[model samples]
Target: MLRTLLLGLVTLAASLVAPAAAAEPVAEPGAATTQNPISSSFSDTYADPAVLRGKDGWWYMYATSDPLHEAPSEFGLMHIARTRDFADWEYLGTVFDEADRPAWTTGSSFYWAPDIRYVDGRYVMYYTVTDTVAEPGPWNFAIGVVTAPTPAGPWTDSGGPVVAPRPTGNGDYFNTIDPALLAAPDGKRYLYFGGFHGGLWVTELDESGLRAVGSPTQVAIGDRYEGSFVVERDGWYYLTASSANCCAGPVTGYSVYAGRSKSPLGPFVDHEGVSLLDSRVGGTQVLAQNGNRWIGVGHHAIVSDVSGQDFIVYHAIDRNDAWLDAPGGVNERPTLIDRLDWIDGWPVARAGAGPSDTPQPAPTTSSSLGIVSDDPAAGEALRAVAGSWDAGTDDDGDAGAVGRLVPADGADDAAVRTEASAPREPRVEADVRVPTGGRVAVEVADSGPSGVSVTVDDAARTLTVEATLGPRTVSDTAPLPSRFDAGEWTSLAVEVRTGRATARLAESRLGDADAVVGVDLPNGLARPRPIQLTVSGGEAQVDNLTVVAAHQPVTERVAEPVPGDEVFAEEFDGDLDTGWSWLRPSSSVTVGEGVLRWPLESVDVVGAANTGPLLLRTPPEGDWMAETKLDLDLGSGTVRNYQQAGMIVRVDDDNLLRLGDVAIWGTRQVEFGKELDENGALRWGAHLGGPVAETMWLRIMHTIDPATGEHRYRSASSRDGVSWRWGATWTLPAHTEPSIGLYAGGGATPATVAAFDWFRLYEVR
Candidate 1:
């Protein structure tokens, strides 16, 4: 679908200026630090960014056809940029000028969402051809391919659409945009395409990698996803796609979600086992707008550094100065980069801290560790030292044969040492299955048993790591998450780098960085030494043993709300506070016994029909957070369209921001919605955030955007009111002090009541 262009009334120059200077910077993981909007130094609007490392060793990024930092008149072609260090970027101009567009396209056809890859021998570029001359229809989006010698691209079109437009018989059609290619492990080139219309899909490509050779399979449902990017990792194909409104200026709720399946063409599912095609929708949040300066974060590309550390490059709009000119103008989406940490088999940006507004450690551009890899399954890297070892197939036949070591004779420890030399800043990883009451230890950079040793105990279900050097020892022991079963083949890794050591465990055969369990090893040994594996008690089978010197920096950050002094609060001890006012008052709303209760009525404050009852109170000026604990039961796994109850920030009946536990179709979601006047019409849109429960705490963090004089409200919810899940942000126009309140209405089915424990507002510190 062609994105609705909300043209900003402002001119080009003002939008190109740098963002507001950041406050005191927060440190990141590496030696040199950088911040997000990494492309802002070069271009202002680099949307739908696709990044790849070139043969020239520079990382090149391509964007949808849009001006770098100017009016539309300056654009009719794709944009490209290059970076040596992600911290510094240089504009490389368009991939093709208007005069060089494909001959099959009309003058009005636009190119978008470039997917670049080095296929076979040369570089291949797959992109969206909107309004192709052959289709002769509006929104005739199709996938097109172009060949180039290198990433810079002196290119040539493949002469036809790779995937043609498929009309759905009605006036509507399935969109064939946002092309992505994944080279599967089985040597098949799978092309993933489609958008919010017709959903995301995957098809096998011909050996030439230019045309689809098979029928497509849907990866995600329509109306929920677009801009699909798939990556295969550790036997799982993870499909990441952008969701929600992509271009709503400052109010844009564009975010990224992820699902994975073992098959390239899959019934992909989220971590919860919910299929992406489910009516309720199932996707793990990958990148969403936190309460930072950046919003509308989506359409991402993942790149791995030399050390195997991953980075996510995407685009985001500055909520403060969102548009290039006026409110509905071109959104200023600058490219952003953050560490992509895999926690418990899922990829989360910056270890779940979301996007960074402060300085962060730059990507490790150079390898500081000199390492080697060894596969113990081949029995080539290890020699039995004090054990009776045998090579045999593991319990899981899919994992192939492994080295099984058991204590021989009367010895309590069975040990094997690697033939390769020790490594600097070493990380030792393996897949192992330990018998009950048994324990397995992986030691790296060892000086006898005095280096760094990670032990996994089956009976206790614990992961213990001890780092010792010259009698100084740093040790930590943590119980494994319930998912870990030592009796099954599990992936484990232990690493020591830069005076710190971390140990990780995954329940499955494919190694997952499940958790970050690290300790400061001030006197730890990082010098080169042979790796050693030992088993005691019973027996343990190990396979795929890999030892590499990875000097990886910690990337996870803890998210905490910064609250100032209390501003306003309602405890509902007896009756409504004198400071409160009611809009469309309802008899069902009652305050007593320390709780305010209201039922889900048939009325609502959506579109032109604004009849829902709201208990409103004016909030303090400037930044603040409004929180409410709501207990609303709408049942689950059933159709409960629009029934909701939670907090609301209201301007009038048709203009407001709402955070509610609402039901849509068959799913229960915490929806953060915004209703506003767009071109004299009432437009309502919402972005789903954190999961929802019957009893949940809803919070809306409001901050003033100094640049645009806009109000930014970000949603967060908590099941236990302790660890909050921050979601997307919605922007409201300036000069309006919206009344903060509570609203419950949408459905009257079964007559359910919403009990709110308390309403509290705090100044943002």
Candidate 2:
């Protein structure tokens, strides 16, 4: 039966150091620290690690170690390691020795693939054991069960195998191995086990834990090997396993694969739509050969830390090593543990040097005596420490470096002022006092866009402002509103954004102040943001100040042809101006607006014999987005037909892209459809399409992209001339564009008319 284990909490301690004496020197900041590998320097031959968290809160890593010494005397000799922070691990002596088991059985104690679960406050271990030394039963190999109260155990076996080899004529009689227990949300228990040649099987375990409830059912089959570790997250169960040969050393290549299913049993398909059971079906390779460090990092288990961070504990053979044999005769294969960070729903191994164990420097305040002032008279040199302060190294190999600064006595509001005329760029340093939980705010003269950034310990904060001459300096403040406090004296830093400047500090008490550490003024311009543009009232506004920092030169440019491809171009030269006759005026498309305007009132329908089929055609067979602005202002009479204008593309005998007016009563309806002729009259056929609501001041856009073979239409309407609601998007299959023109068929009354204005089309490649 499956069980849930809750590990107990582990305690963490914070270390503190004492203040340095006078004249002691300190190393510069940014000094490098050395780190050690957590997994190296251990016994080899360990692979296929099954890591679990016990109730003691320590991580227990169990693996299939050397298989050669599996005799009853060497059973349970496989390795185990315990760790708390995942950095330093305590090597636990091997606790299991098969020879210690009762002499009632006839098998050797060779074990492989060990798994541990905490049930009923006891630790239960399951492993595959085979009797190569003696033959006492029909089965050569079987799963053995043992129980212990603690992970480091003197285990008591059940005296016999829990699962024996299947009898002849049974479907899965070949081999039984790789057993995994899964606890479902419904509180039921299930067992899954299988191997390379025989396939995987699942069975429900009865509450008593000794028997299967029913006959075992075949879950999956084929060459998919069975180091299956099943995990469920977000309502889906994921079965992760290793594929291909894993123990051939460097020459042996293996990868991890996974498949997900809504249920725990049956019908598992890979991302590529192939059943996992099929020999040809390949699953996703989550981790593969990545340099020499992680040549083969599969057949592993995941262990979650107290903070819920998951780490992958697996065995990897060094590329330099050829085999498990070593000078000590102990396999050199070592178990490696690395933090796995999730990105886009997939786990990625963090590849870098391990974290350092050295403590960081403390943030310094503004009033301590050790603070150094660049110039006592000029005052340009501020209480800024050089960037070379080292926290790890001690001066004279015994104590840290110190600086001293004296504050002017008496004056309640004492201030240190610096003249602008110092070195081309000047800086200041002064020790300022920081009360516990207190905040410091420094006021500087408004110089311009130039600014300064302050750093407390390792954290940095920036303030932008200008600087002025004579007493106008930038001050570094401590206990800033957002900074968290550390108990001891820490380093404070100030860096100038632009131009050289000097500074000084004034505080209430000089003795209680923290050391003012470093100040640096580097010459450079601030970063800029480019590509900022705004379009309004049919005009494009550009800003030159916005500049993009480019690592590589952007040389590719597009040239605009003088006369581009005109899919549908019309001048409306004829004078039939009534609805089909002449145009009526509206606010959107005004004849007085100087652009070609189409009114929104119904009138007589007029068409010349030659221009009856007024349509626009493009030379290329491609998708395009056409846009046009129109103003519809029908003051009196019924406004219809031309009130809503639309465009059409890919017109065929049966289907065409039609978007525009199909009005009923006084409301204007905007729609796109596949035009079909029922009995000579145009009719919209039902498909994956819909209609849009008509509005005034409309800019309609129709887009076509050949890559997707879909034509889309969008529009925006405005009432107060400011804000606009871009209408819904409609799409259709790409077809050839032959004719495009204004169609005003329905009108509110007999003599109403609609007008049109200017239009433009943009094609996307």
Candidate 3:
């Protein structure tokens, strides 16, 4: 299927450019400048976008576009767009065109989806062509091929159509478009294609790339339209496509849909058990429309920018005023772009609305930044150096006898504090140890009525403070001077003389001759503080309250579980235990929770589990139900596989019932069958691939009628002591039993540890 699809679209090897009008930059509002759409002025349409991140730090976006809006063109052109930031797009021109017109597609009027790839130093563009007027036949379209040296090309076609329309009886006879090429990790090339009027199909292509190596397989099918694109991430192949009505503006719309499969060819299924084509948002809707305020979104392409930011580009009708009308109505729709973020491996658009136009303080980018400190308590004060203070006027009054502190980024309500008095006790101390060649900037915010000078390392570094009645933020930058001496610690002390204040340290960017020293904030201050911090913006916070002392400790106890009498226990000496009678039910007991839990052992004994069938005075008749929970230890202290443990329902002795294990053969395989051996012991079989180790839980359910001689069985298992997979149902000859008991057998290797919680039998209506 891949080879056939690839052949159809790779015949043309020439590059052609569309004569598009030059785009003019529009003057946008301030908000628009920061949050403008990536493909702001380009006329774009989404088919299936083939995205590739080139080694040159550019993302190449190639997709099919309608050459002349509504008019039919001979072939589709592969449009290319490049970008670094998902928010900004750069048009890279068309990489494939039908100017030379390959013989097979010359008369065809439409090019559907074009997938592009850069392989072996050459560019390959795969595209599908549709003929509005069929060549006097039922099948009306074909997939063609084109190629180029660079993404932008000038000439060459593959001579003819690589993949033609299928035979009349084939399922994909209506159309063979929307081709998605995937270069599997194992060096194999696979192609997935199909669209509206047909289901998704897959086939392999030989290394030569001229034909399909195997029969094309129908992977998914439905009544609605479907387009396919394959992307591999983290070893998982994701098949994403658009569903429902696309391309008819807002009123006539569509939405994107996706699913995953381990193989290139798939039994693709959505969350619901429906084919991708028939899968719609609810009923008739296609792609959901999304934009600033508009809906009706469809035709999407997912690409990653130069900076490795993923983005989704799609066309949406901006119908804020006009109603979405069909049958040739005038509606202007434009292409929009939004950042795509991966949440739990799925694409989400425009996830976080980060800061757009808000100005931030310019980061320090110098080599030799230092700190100045003077402590009045240490008897050192009023010291000024030449390059320490800027000669700018303090318009906000945050300047002391020295220069004023400039608010770099329009800080609100900024003020300067100048307090001259006896030095107060240091509220907090920090050891300032700078990394070899880095500088640190410390920021402080004042939350008090007045401003006070803060001392660092007994050195009085004047911090101009701004105080607002509510909340005011003030900041200061301090550069660390020298490299740290190994095994040596430096201390920084902060003390306030008159007013109360709190400070915090932010971040530290790492570098060489430009390293940053971390500052630690002291504890017990009224404000939030940093304990040990790095240079980027690490600082300690202090409040008006004084430090308090420490106190003592206490102890407490919780709850526990109580054990009951052992109704049945096997010491594992290869012998059957006593006090256990597995019985067949007539009007009592049933498997409700998959596995039966002996209620006698549970806190809510009667409510959660059941206990009976001890001494059967009469043989119960009619249909019966039985189940048991088996706990097995596989390995890694967890259950692995094939650990059979459940109930033997309708047992004449032990040879006529069933058993079930949830986790079988590494995969969950449910089993239900009749016992073949006549040792009065039933031999039920489960074909799970491996051994069972750690604790695994299993449950078995059976319904049988003694008079009618009819019986049915079901089984299930769990790993975490909860949850079970009910196996396929089975039936057998009915039997009578005056006595029945839960039976558990150890595996061939006898799982080092095995146990059964409980068992029960009942009759269902």
TM-score-better candidate, 1 vs 3: 1
- State each model's C-alpha RMSD to the native: 12.2, 26.7, 23.3
lDDT of 3 at 138: 32
Q: Quantify how close model 2 is to the true structure by its C-alpha RMSD in Å.
A: 26.7
Which lDDT tens digits does candidate 3 get at residues 1-765? 111112133211100111112211222344223232234444323334555433222445565543313223223455677654334567666644545556565444446566665433345666776642334453456666676654555536676555666644643365677776666534466677765455667777666443456787776553333566666543445666654344322223344555656666765544333333222211111123321233334455555321123455554444332222221222333445554444445444432221112221111111011111111111112112111212232121111112222222432112222122212321332223222223222223333442322323212222122223334334343432222221122223333222444322111100001111222222222232221111211221111111111101001111111112323333333323344444323132223333332211101101112222321222234434443445543333223433444444443433343443333322222233333432332233221211122455454343443446554444444444343323333344444343344433323343233355544444433
Candidate number achieving the greatest TM-score relative to the actual structure = 1
Ranking of models by TM-score:
1, 2, 3
State the local distance difference test value for candidate 3. Answer: 0.37
lDDT of 1 by residue, 366-446 (tens): 322232222243535567888766776644433445677888877888988877775677766665777678799888777
Model 1 residue 500 distance off true place after TM-score fit, in angstroms = 15
Model 1: lDDT to the true structure: 0.74
Candidate 2 runs further than 4 Å off: 1-39, 65-76, 102-107, 132-139, 167-173, 208-211, 326-332, 341-765
Ranking by lDDT: 1, 2, 3
Error of 2 at 32 (Å): 16
C-alpha TM-scores of all predictions = 0.67, 0.40, 0.39
